[model samples]
Each structure stands twice: as C-alpha cells, then as structure tokens.
Target: MTTSVSEKVYRRGPFPVKFRCLEVLRVTPITPHVVRITLGGEDIQGFHSEGADDHVKVLFPEAGKQRPVIPTMGPTGPVLQPGEKKPDSRDYTPRRFDPVAGELDLDFVLHGSGPASSWAAQAKPGDMLGVGGPRGSLFVSNDFDWYLLAGDETAIPAIARRLEELPEGARAIVFIEVADASEEQKFSTRANMTLKWLHRDGAEAGSTDLLNQSIRTLDFPPGDYFAWVSGESLAMRPIRDYLLNERGTNKSWVRVTGYWKRGHADHVHDSKN
Candidate 1:
C-alpha cells in the first residue's frame, strides 16, 4: 500500500536483495502499448521498491529451454553452457513492489518489435519469467522546489507513476512526446504538474526533435530542482547536454538515460549515448 503524506516513508528500513530470482505472478494490459507484469513469490517478502524509475533486470528463458537458468553464487558471477545464450534482457521501472503480498509490478512499453516488448505483449498469467532487483532508485524526491520531467512514449509509465507519487502542492513541469496526440495518457498527480504533449505523428519512435526544441525555450527555476529524462539515444543526448552544459545541473540532480536506441536491436545497459 502507498503510504500517506502524513507518515514518513522509511528508506533504510529494508531493501530487496541486490538480485534474486522472481517468477511471473500475473500480466495485465494498461494501454494498447503498455503491459503491467507482476512477478514474485515467497522470495519477494523482503523486497522494498521505493519509487518510480527504479529498474530491475529481467532474465528471459533461453531458446529451447523451459526456463532461464538461475545463477549460483559462483566465483565469476554466473556460468552457463559454452554455446548457450542468455535470454534478451531489458530495464524497466518498478511500478510497485508489495512485500507483504510477495508481488512486484513492472510496466513495459509494448511498442518495439524487440524480444522484450514482444514477450510482455504475449505474456499471460502463470507463464514463468525471471526478475532481479530493487537494484537502486533514481532519487527525485518532492523535497525539491520544482522538477522538469520529460520523455517519449517509452518513458510514459515511469513518468505517470512518479507524477502520481508527488505530494500535494508540489510543483513539476512535464513534457511527454509521442508518435501522435492519440497516444496521450490520462494521469492523476497530487502535485501541481503542468504537462505539454509533443507529437510527431508520423516520425519514427525516437528520431523527433520535439522534446529538445520545447525544453530549450522554457526558463528553469533557480531553487532546488530536478530533471528526469529518458528515451532513445538520439533524443536523450540533447536533453542531457542541455541540462548539463546550459543549466549546469549536477549529474546527481539530472538523471538522463537512453532507454533504447532507434536502430540498435539490443537494449543498452549503461547508456552514455
């Protein structure tokens, strides 16, 4: 359950293991291009997922194998057969993780034709999957005076989730870019969030200049502020550079990440692009 604003949420109380195996408990569609998959078992009792944008590494089943191989605490991390391959992996924000209920929620943008996207699109209840996390959370607490949240469609779930988590009377500006206006989402946030939708009706998923062009014009507030931006490689770079070079935001206050690149087939783990 979400804690009320009147109560202080404890961060150091407990956090899930750095990594652990999780099974698929259920999967449900939130939108035409987004699916929410909850994964866990008795193993999730200790998991503490604090906020939106916290990622978990999902291990997929290897081809021809019934399931993904669970790693043993070995000398060199993990070891598999010489020719065996690890399942395609992706990074996703933890929408929620209920420790008492032993369940964890992950939201996936089911647009890419990639393995991870396709898997979530076709996933069903009882289907087995693997998860490892509560790895770490990107901190953009409401303690700040203001915030600037921007991203493409792939970042929608996390952005929307964070907005809803903001305390009442807090302030943040949100800019969401999508393929078209029809892809817009209805969101609920306690904070005073002003959202601007940037649409590139026919342009490729992450190639548009909409987000950069708009952010360039906005005058940022001087008080303590945070900016969280995520999306394709080409798009993420411009935003990160602008925040770093122009606004002089410390790397800690500005978390810009490239979730996936347009032409790259594999997901980027530590994207500096």
Candidate 2:
C-alpha cells in the first residue's frame, strides 16, 4: 500500500532507486479478474524487495513498442531524455521476488479501461515492461500483541504477504472485501489469523460502508496492535477516524492508506495516519 504524499509513514531503502527494464516471461490468470504477470531478465539483478507492501511503478510503452524510454537517476532526480514519449505508468505491489532466479511477480486487477489494466488484458510473453523505484520498503514490525489488516482487492497482495511473513504463533485479524466469492483468495500463514470475507455482490465499489461496519462489530483482540488499512479513499476515511478517535490507537502504530480514490481518473494513494 502507498502512503499518502502528505503523511510520513515508516519506510526504508537505498535512495536513488534503480530502474529495470523487464520482459514478460509469462502471463497467467490467477482469478476471473486478476492476472499474474511474471517478469524476469538479467536486468532484474540486484533487485531488493524486503517489505510485504512494497510497490513499483510499471511503465507501459505505446502499442507495438518494444520498450519505454526509461529515465536515469540524475544529479537531482529522474532525468528524462529529451523528445521522447513518456509511457503510461502505475504502481503495483510486488507479489513475489526471487533474486536467485531473477524473477518478480506482479498482480494486476483488470476492472477499468485504464492503461495498466488494458495492457495486462492484452499482454503476452516477450512483451517489455519498465519498472522503477519501490523507491523504498514500508517495513512494519511483526512484534506486536496482535495485528489487524483490512482492505479490498487492491490490497490483497500486501495483506497476503504480511500474513505469510508473520512469525508462527503470532495473532492476526484480517478482513477483505471484494466483488463476490469468486474474487476471494486463499492465504497460507503460520500466524494465528481469523480471516473474514465480505462480498459487495452488486454494490458499487467504494460506495458502501461494509468495511467500517465490520470493524465496528468485531470484538478486537486486546493489547498493543498495529492496524493497517487501505482501499478506496472515501471508504477508508471513516475507518481511519474511528480507529484514532474512538479506539484511541497510537498514531505511530497505525497506517491507513487510500490505494485509489473514487471519481478521480488517476488513482492516488492518500492516508491520514
């Protein structure tokens, strides 16, 4: 999940992140609406993704182009070459990173007519995709009395990764909302976790109170807990406020992010904590 441009969340990384021009090794369908694109090559060397919630910007060149014109790390920042088409780009979670094999798996949700979704729908093996940053890793410690994780389909990659990385015998509570049962995913974790699946059925995404309502009804585990919440911007606002105002959760330990905002063409992540 991306932190709001305005908030200071926990993160660490080697600055001036490197860029990699990856090739699509294979494209496989993970679900009815989700696809896993496996990217690898010699360029993936030295790739480091230590946080479960790390995200990279995927650059898509114009149709029929072999690769996008990627920028270099300039003395100041990214130095874009002159007179070149800037390809479309979007942030996505790194589902799996195998440095030994030089492979990085990214999951994409195909729901909109946006460039990223459209590209994934038609992508094939040997296709070129540019990736940059992560710029860093949001490393939330697993050392807590318990953990609460909640979000929609966009947040699944991070949520699943966190569950898998938690120590054995640790306690976790998870809630995920999606289109229906078909969108629900199975997660394997050694942590003591209670997972709940909420279906929107026919309701429009980001136009309901399901997430907030669920959090209010559940009897949360006691003691020091780190809560991570992300999804539609409007839907996340109430939940964040409730946790801070009503629950009195510590500001430093809580992270609430809007992976995307409704009614906005570009999906920008924003957070209040």
Instruction: Write down the TM-score of every candidate.
Output: 0.83, 0.93
Deviation (Å) of 137 in candidate 1: 2.6
**Per-residue lDDT of 25 in model 2:** 97
Most lDDT-accurate candidate = 2
For every candidate in turn, the CA RMSD to the true structure comes to 5.0, 3.3
Q: Point to the candidate with the largest TM-score.
A: 2
lDDT of 2 at 214: 92
Please report, as a residue range, the 10-residue window in candidate 1 with the lowest summed lDDT: 5-14
lDDT of 2 by residue, 66-173 (tens): 787687777776678889777788888899998888899999999878888888998899988999977777767677889999999899999999999999988999
| TM-score of candidate 2 versus the correct structure, residues matched by position | 0.93
